[model samples]
Target: MVPWSLWEKLTTAPWLSINAAGQFVQWFNHLLMLIPFGAVIAVALGISLIRRRWWSAVAAVVIPMVAYSLNIWELFIEQLGWWLLIWLISFALCRTATHYLMLSTTCLKIANRCQFFWPLYVGLCSIVIFHPSWLVGVASALIALIPTFICQRLRLFAQLPSKPLEQAQMLGANKAQRMQWVAKRWLTPRLQNWRARTLQQSLLYCAFAGMIGLPGLGQHFYQGLSQGQHAMVGQTILTLLLLQLLLWSIDHAHKEVL
Candidate 1:
């Protein structure tokens, strides 16, 4: 049976206090990993406008704003430099690698063959390397996502109609031109979907990294459990649940628009 003190602690523990400041910092860092969410929405809005997809544009803007609110600005302001640095680094790496894979059949084949082994690479880096926890966590999430992103894009390419590409080739379009045309027509419309999936998976991996000593809600929860801090454990669980609910609502709204 649980002690009365445990129940009392749970009831009386303050949600915000000097002692909980570290948890708030960890939460901020965790939310920082979501920079991709904002990037995706911004790009989606642009693409929708260019393509004259009015409903898509409205849904893109309104749904995310309603679901996530303007609190993101607070996160950005709190860690403006760090947030921009991480977003730039991650965006550049992902775009370069993805474009390279899309344009090079040889590289695509290699990535496909070795994609399933990415976990080993992540394990090696996390266990053997001596990087900062935030770096390790972000790197691990990116590494873990490589195969998934590759496979999804490959499937997208395969399912796309080849007639347009063939016609472009027959009209003396260069390889780069053909790739650009395909991206503009087929890929741009779907950037939000892809980025949403990436963000969801990234959050999961980042949280999991907490088990390995990364400073986030997952680490906080782990520590709470280890030290038998029931109040902290409950708070962490509640926070995670709320995060999951937010993701679910976004996905649901996205699907409804589709």
Candidate 2:
């Protein structure tokens, strides 16, 4: 390991230069690290889309609350009820706020970045100060999904034709059955594409999470840059190239499905 003091005096840092195999490994590692994050985001989006509105809001709040509760447990040492109370208050505020903001793009942006507002919340808990954990990634990824739920709900509201419900009623299709069929037909493809993109967004959010003291390449990259380790930063950028390739492939896959 390079000492921080030694790093400061070094004439040149060598890790900046990576070979083809090394680059491949870096990209693969970063992607692998984020796959769980992508999966979590996908599930959260699916639930929000299907459950709709207030339920979706509750799902988004619960994810981070559970995460924060566990982190708090390590600090409070048996105050589960206290932490739960705090989270419930938060959920009430979020629900009321969601009711007002509803469908705006600004609301969407705020939801996806909800944790960004409480970035310091993690720091308040003593357990997270010295340790980095995957729990943070899961919590943050889920927390970031608030905007996705809001956006998907509003998108469905706009896209679903009023004609289908009326026509289905005339055809003797009950409300639940018609909604099931109509929503499936119209929203499946869009949701599939959205899921793929959401995965990418979750990964990017993880990078930002990394900067804010979570464990992963984002933090690693931030630390390297802070220490003036250009080589390490270079590796992180290459990993980003890999992410772009994956995203390109996902986009093409969506088109093919369409």
Candidate 3:
């Protein structure tokens, strides 16, 4: 016999009934959860400045700022599937070297020269510290980093250059030839690798977010499981699966110019 948890999730599709109180509660949860994102930005900036690396500061601080300013933040909070898509696009478009640099400087263990532990550094510096909840910021950065390092080490993915076509021109290729080469070789292979890494990282982020009680799909899945909200559980599972399929199909279709 199937376990009750498994049976409920698979068999009991929950109806989207109108729950005004639930709606309000959801909104409030979003607000509370997102307040930390600002701290995430601030700390990233603070770290960059302390390290005297303005480029890192700009990437760590600026991109998320732009995403939030453009209301992409809200989309992620309200719709997990869309949020995953947003992350996918960002990952696909970034320069390979730049993304690796950011990950190394901010998240990975590449630089830890401080004799003091990070907590003590925070204390001695008298800079606003992690408020006990600050681990969320560290964890979020790490969540993005682990796969990035793995990808770099294995060359599992390559980033799209800001101007891949220009390189062909520098080699004296005409416009037509340059375009053909890019489509046939660089663009497609890079896209394929990017898609594979994106899917894997997205899954990692989803799982980590749930473990840490972060907002969006992870939080939703966690709550549903805890409350025995069978319908919500089914919804989250299907949403993640559909996202994976979409990613795979998009990569497949763009195989020529990925």
RMSD (CA, Å), each prediction:
14.4, 18.5, 19.4
| Per-residue lDDT of candidate 3, residues 1-258 (tens digit) | 999998888665443335755787798887775654544446445655665656655565544454455444553334433444444444454335335644554532232222113223322222123233334434544544554455443342133333456677787878776655554564444445453344344333443333232345555565677799986666555544443343333333332332
Best by lDDT: 1
Candidate 2 lDDT tens digits, 1-258:
999888875634554446755887888875764454445335444544554534543443454344344442121111222223333354455545555555576765665465333433443332254353344344444554554455456455445544556778888977776776676676665555453343333333333333323334445556676799987666554543333333233333333332
Give a tens-digit lDDT track for model 1, residues 144-226. 56645664565566444444777888889888778767765765455444433343334333333332322344455556777
Shift in Å, residue 180, candidate 3 = 30
| Pairs with steric clashes in candidate 2 | 16-231
State in Å the error of residue 155, model 1: 3.7
Name every residue pair that clashes in candidate 3. 14-231
Q: lDDT at 215 for candidate 2? A: 38
lDDT of candidate 2?
0.46
**Which scores greater on lDDT, model 1 or model 2?**
1
State in Å the error of residue 131, model 3. 14
